[model samples]
Every structure is written in C-alpha cells, then in structure tokens.
Target: MTAAEAARQVAKHPIQARNPIQVLGRSALSAVRMVGGVGVFAVRGTIAALSPPWFFNQLLRQFVAIGFFSLPVVGLTAIFTGAALALNIYTGGGRFNAEQVMPQIVALGITRELGPVLAALMLAGRVSAAIAAEIGAMRATEQIDAMRTLSTDPFRYLVGPRLLAGVLMLPLLTVVADTIGVSGGWLVATRVLDFSSAVYIRNTVDFLQGWDILSGLIKAAVFGFIVALMGCYHGYNAKGGARGVGRATTHAVVSSAILIFASDYLLTTFFTHAAK
Candidate 1:
C-alpha cells in the first residue's frame, strides 16, 4: 500500500520472474550434460565389447537371461496385439466394405511396426530394470571396485556381455513376435470373424515383403542397444546407496522406453524413404 512497499514488491517481482528463467536454463544444461555422458559411456562400452580378452561365460549367461527368459511375455504380447489389431482393422474396413484387407493389413502391421516396438518396450521394462538394479547393487556394495582391484575391467566383464546379448537377442525375439502375432491375427480372423484360415494365411504370406520383416529386425537390434546402454549407463554411475540403485532402475526403464519410441520413428522414416 505504501510507495516503499510497492517499490520493493516491483523489484521482487522481477527477481521472481528471473528465477524461472534461471531454472529453465539449468535444466537445459543438465539435459545436455546427461546426453553427452550417455554418449561417452556408450562409446566406452562399445570399445570394451570389441576388444580382446572376451568373457564367453558371462555372455552366455546374459543370452539366457535376456533372450530365453523373455520369450513368454513377448509371445503373449504379440498374440494379443495381433488379435486386437485384426479386430480393429476388420471393423474399420467394414465401413467401406473392404474387410477382406484384414489379413494383408494385419501381417504388414505386425511385421513392420507393432512386433518390434512392443517386444522392445517389454524388454525395456523387464530386462533394462533388471540390468540397472543388478549393476547398481554391485556398485553400491563396492563389488565393481573389487573387480577393478582384481584387474578385471568392469565394462569388459559386465557391460560388454550384456550389450552383446541384447543386440543379438532382440532380433530373435522380434522374429518370434512377428510369427506369433500373425498367427494370432489368423486365429482371430478365422474363429471370430469367419474368415477362411487357408485364405488368410495365403494372403498374409503373399502380401508381406522381405523388406518389411528386415526393417523390423533392424529396429529390434537398435532398440536392444538402447535398452542395454541406458541400463549400464545409469547403473555404472549410480551414487548414494539403496536409494541410488532404485533411482537408477527407474531411470533406466524410463529412458529406454523414450529412446525406443524416438528411434522407432527415425528408423521408420529412413526405411520408408529407402524403400521408395
């Protein structure tokens, strides 16, 4: 109400306005630094993976953990997704009396996009979290340091195996997903939609091209690398203790999912242009 009070309030309002700008600047810098850190970590991990003195035992274990154990969930996701896609496509097609396109559309959708993306998302939740927690726990308990004391490179022994396993396993998993998803569509179309099973199978096989399947597999491999990279990056740098490990696990999953979607879009665009 007083002139002095009003002047003070006016001055404080400018400072308050500047505070948000400062916060925004800090956040942007932090994001840039985080991205740079992850990129450097990825390069180091790749080098460790490619270098000699490889650990086949660790690699084999990761293959089983990342690939074999992941089949059930991926299969379930694929089958249900395919069936749902078929239903939606058929319903939409009915509007224009084009329902017969269900088989071709379902196959194309599963092989081109849904199969690889869903499989990666599932692994991002399951495998990425597991990897981050495991490595974070090792870091928390100083076991990673212990490995260093023994002259064992933690990146070579731990990160490399997991990274290689992820890159190799995801494509295999995507293939299974594609097969199961198409089968699901076929099942739904035949049993529920009264489509002829033989015709549906024939149409799907005829309509799908090699490039469609190959592109999905390529996306799977890239997604696998992203999942493993995020997990290792967060876990390797985790601080504090139990709380840090939990935070790393959460970050790993969130980052992996975001990167998967973003990269999927990029890869899809590249493949589309290339195909043309």
Candidate 2:
C-alpha cells in the first residue's frame, strides 16, 4: 500500500472498514474539481481582460509600484552579476589565453539570460508574496465580499492592474538590468582586471546580435506575466486565515519560478531558430 493508504487506514473510524478504494476515488474527484476550478478562473480572467471597460487608475498604480519599486533591487543584482561574470570568464578563459572574450560573453550572458531570469525570480519572491499577503488579508477580512456587495468587479480592479504592471514594468526593469550589467563588466575589465576599457566595449558591441538581447527581453515580459498571474490567482483564491495566506504566498513563488524557467527554454529555442 502507498504511504497515503497506510495513513488513511490508521485514521479510519473504528466502526468502518479501512477502504483504500474509497479514499482513492475521493482524492481523484478532488483533483478533478481543482482542475475544473482553475480552468474556470483562467477563462474568466481572459474574458475580463478583453472587455473594453477597464480600470486605468489601478493599472497605473500596479505599474508604478512593481516596476518603479523593483528598480533598486534589480539594478543591484545585475551589477554584481556582471562583475562576477567577468571575473569568472577571465579565470576560465585564461586557461586557453582567451581572457579577451570577457566583455562579449558577460554582455551576452547578462542580457540574454541572467538579466531577465534573475530579475523575474527576485520580483517573484518580492511581488508575489506582497500581493498574496495583502489580498489574502483583505479576503480574510471579507473586503472582497464587500466589493461584490457594492457591485464592483474584483478582477478588473485587482487582477488587471497587476497584470498590466508586470507586463510593462518587467521590460523596463530589464533595460535597466541590461545596461547596468554591461557597465559592471566594463568596470571589472578596465579597473580590476587591467584590460583596456575601449577594447572591451567595442568587442562587446561588435559581437552582440540583436536577437540575443531581444530574446531575453521577451522572456522578461513573459516571466513578469507569469509571476503576476500566479500571485493574483493564488491571492484571489486564498482560503482560511493567516496560515492559508502563507501557503498562497509560497505557492505563488514556487509556481512563478517554475514557469519562468520553463518559458526561458521555449523563448531560447524560438530565438535560436529565428537567428538561423
């Protein structure tokens, strides 16, 4: 028997038979119900987004809060990542006396992969948790019900703005990250590693293909969408009290991170093939 079966048997009522079949059937039904509920919500959200009557103010707030507030953290990560990438490349390439490739490699890696991926993960943790907690708390306090009672559509006010914020802010944040990352590599190559700054920058420019940068930015937008969607989805559905809110927060981060990595691979494939 599975561990779940054994646990069920142990918790079985004294007068009832320990029926694993019933347990399995109930569990299967629960799974199906959950899947159906998710489909409903996804459809509902999509339809709502397509509707012409929208909440512009809330959308603007989401953009400013998520994109503007996220700048400092994203910038810091990119700068450090760029510097460290340069050092690592210099060390590895020096084995073949090819340390000159640091600038181009760092630039490519940061813009095409690390910048968007890392920024999304970071924002996932920060933004997702905050959204889940705030929404969950409001839910626990019955504010959602209050909105419904007032004839307000919660999805348009809450989910739409957040979704728009993520889509918009992510690309902007990526630009900042990309620029900062290249500058970081410049610093390391010129001052710390004693390479000529002009040579590094020029080579980086010459080696860069448009697709490399474009692919990463596209991934950022997708990642941002996933992160915000998961956050709002989990938050809107959050159950119970404080404990449920915590669980929703955890699920948002975990789900968003997985989707980001998965989307990155697909985006990479598209860019690679297009370039060919």
Candidate 3:
C-alpha cells in the first residue's frame, strides 16, 4: 500500500521463495551421504567376506536362519499373490472376452516382478528387523567391542557371513516363490475361475522364458543384499541402549523396504529397455 512497505514485502517474498530450495538442497545432500555410507559398508563387507578365515559354520547357520526358516512365509505370500493376480486378471480380461489370457498374464506377472519383489519385502520386514535387533543388542552389551579387543574382526565374524548368505539364498527362495505362485494361478484358474487346468498350464509354460525367471532371481539377489546391508548398517552403528536398538530395527526395515522398491523400479526399467 505504501512505497517502503511494498519494497520490503517484495524482498521478503524472494527470501521465502529461497527457503524451499535451501531445504531441498540439504535433503539431497543428506541422501547422497547416506548412499555413500551404504556403499562403503558394502565394500568393507565384501572384502571381509572374500578374505575370510572362512566362517563356514557361521555361514551355514545364517543359511538356515535366512533361507530355510523363510520358506513358509515366502510360499504363503506367493500363493496368495498369484491367486489374487489370476482372479484380477481374469476379471479384467472377461470384460474384453479374453479371459483365456489369464494364465499367461499371471505367469509373467509373478515370474518377472511380483514374486521376487514381494518375497524380498516380506523378508525385509522379518530378516532386516531381526538382524538389526540382534546386532544392536550386541552393540549395547559391548560384545562387539569385546570381540574387537580380542583381535576378532567383527566385519568378518558378524557381517560377512550374513551378507553372503543373503546374496546366495534369496534366489533359491525366489525360485520356490515362482513355482508356488504359478501353481496358485493354476489352481485358481481351474477351480475358482472355471478354466481347464491343462490349458492354463500349457499357456503359462508357453509364455514363460529363461530370461523372465533369471531376471527375477537377479532382482532377488540384489534385494537380499539391500536387506542385509541396511540391517547390519543400522545395527552396527546404533548407540544408546534399548531405545537405540528399537530405533535401529525400525530404520532397518523401513530403509530396506524403500530401497527394495526403488531398486526394483530401476532394475525393471533396465530390463525393459534391454528387452526392447
């Protein structure tokens, strides 16, 4: 309304406009630092894994913990996912009088994407939280520091075996998921959707390819690493006491799940481009 007041208001508007940009810049910088931390952790863990005094027993134990114990949850998730996918696809297809394509669609959806991604998400919730809580407790109790004092390499003795187990075993879990998922689709198709089992199976087999399954396995491996890495990183760095351990567990699961989805999108994009 007045000359001086208008000038001051105009200047204030510019400063306010810069606030959001400044906040965004700081956010991006933090994200870069977090990524750098994870990358460094990966490098250290990888080196410890290869240069190991070979913790074969620890690795075997991790395999049982991560892979074997995970079967039931993964299988159930896959079966329900596949059945739901089939039903949804069949319903959508029927609107176009193409319900017969449900089998092929279900197979492709599961093997190429959903099977690995969903299984990884489930494992992230279970395994990541478990790893973080266990290691966080060790940190709180000073056991990890004690190991270091005794000339034991914590990276090798603790992180390496779990990391290696996750990288190796997730693919196996994905394979089981894929198999069960396809079977579930078959079941829904025949019993619930009123389709011939043989025809559905044949369609699924015909549409499937080596690359479809291979890509899903590869995604599973990456997701597995993400899960283990986040868990160990949060757990290893956690401070304070019980509250700190709780925070680390929550962070591990949240970060792993977010990274899984982000990496899934990138991998899917790359694979789609490569296929083309």
For each candidate in the order shown, give its overall lDDT on alpha carbons.
0.93, 0.84, 0.90
Off by over 4 Å in 2: 1-39
Q: Per model, how many backbone clashes are there?
A: 0, 0, 0
Ranked candidates (TM-score, high to low)? 1, 3, 2
Q: What is the lDDT of residue 19 in candidate 1?
A: 66
**Candidate 1, run of 10 with poorest lDDT:** 6-15
User: Each candidate's root-mean-square deviation in Å?
Assistant: 6.3, 4.4, 7.0
Model 1, which residues run further than 4 Å from truth?
Answer: 1-18
Q: Can you give the TM-score per candidate against the true fold?
A: 0.93, 0.87, 0.90
Instruction: Give one digit per residue, the lDDT tens place, for model 1 in 225-257.
Output: 999998999999899999999999999999999
Q: Write the per-residue lDDT of candidate 2 for residues 205-270, one digit (tens) a residue.
A: 999988778888888988888888888888889999999999989988998898899999988888
Candidate ranking (lDDT, best to worst): 1, 3, 2
Write the number of the candidate with greater lDDT, choosing between 1 and 2: 1
Q: Give the per-residue lDDT digits (tens) of candidate 3, residues 1-276.
A: 875564455455645535665456555665787889989999999898788497899899999999999999999999999999999998899899989889989999999899999889988998999999999999999999999999989999889998998888889999999999999988888998889878988888998999999999999999999998899999998899999999999999999999999999999999999999
Regions of candidate 3 where Cα sits further than 4 Å from its true position: 1-29
